[model samples]
Target: MADEVKLHGLAGSPFVCRVKIALKVKDIKYDFVVEDLINKSADLVKYNPVYKKVPVLVHNGNPISESLVIVEYIDDVWKGVSILPHDAYEKARVRFWAKVVDDKCLPALFKAIGSHAQEQAVAEAHEQLQFLENELKVKGSKFFGGDSINLVDISATFIAYWVGAAEEALRITLVTKDKFPKLKEWSDNYINCQAVKDVLPPREVLVGFFKSRFGKA
Candidate 1:
């Protein structure tokens, strides 16, 4: 089998973006195969038999699912500018924050934003944002990993891209100076980075679409 890397994922998904960011940071070239997640292709199922999710990374015919796992795999296989920390404890810490984003944070944001009741959605979103802000403070880092974007940054960046759409869909603002200053500043800087800015979906389009569909409005 050829030692080639290929990514099968949806274009607009934050999960896929995570994989893209890792690949870009490492300067690892790969093939891109966009998939319709709603109507998953047979190839996607073959690659990821369980979840059949997007952001599946195929490496020399071996398949890996989950964006974070894919990222670790990429980092290990093609080490360049190392994204994960050298210390084991620090690596675990980065992974811990990543888990928070993957398990608690991302799901809550999506659910709260996708809820039909505007008030409830906004309330939940606010609560989650507060928790997130506290985490940022406790960590005392520019990102979850600090300084340069790391695994924690890669993990968080996935859902951070969708805040605009979430706010519009739920008719509430999560990022504000009074509320999440560090997060807001970090988000602005993160998005404005040439890698993210040039590749992200149009904000207006995301808002309009999610506002209609996810909001059920």
Candidate 2:
């Protein structure tokens, strides 16, 4: 079987970036095919027949969809970077947090992003941050992975970067040290990691994109 891998995604999408970041961390080499989600390609539709989403990872013509699922597939295939813990229980814990990111966090933030009213959206955005603060009460533990960047951290890319970008785009404050200190700390640490830092789309770029998106909604 051919060892070649390819990823079809766009530049600013957090979901697409998740797969890219995972590939980079795993030190896996793959071709990047930028897709116009508004006008998707036949290949994307062909591979991801269910959702027709970008961020479809094609490993030697074998396609995988969904950002988190792609990340897990990459981790399993690369078997080098160890994005998830080796221990079964710890791995379950990490995956659990990853699901928290997908199920609890991303949807809230997405609603905040494409909301018609910026004011209420900003308020809802803060609610998501509040949940993170409550969950991370273990104190002093860094990152969602509790001291190291893990699958959850990558999965929560929307919450991490898009939250800040959405707040700025909306001209509102969401993450504050006074309320979500530990989460604030985690956000700070998360952005600085080389893996994340290098991959983050420019804030101004995101701001422009989100501003237009919010305005259009």
* lDDT for each candidate structure: 0.77, 0.80
- RMSD in angstroms, all models? 2.3, 2.2
- Top lDDT model: 2
User: Candidate 1: where is the Cα deviation over 4 Å?
Assistant: 1-3, 215-217
Each model's TM-score? 0.88, 0.90
Could you give candidate 2's per-residue lDDT for residues 150-187 as a string of tens digits? 88789878777777887788775656789778777777
List, residue by residue over 88-160, the lDDT tens digit for candidate 1. Answer: 9989888887887777777776776666435676566667667668877887776666767788777877456
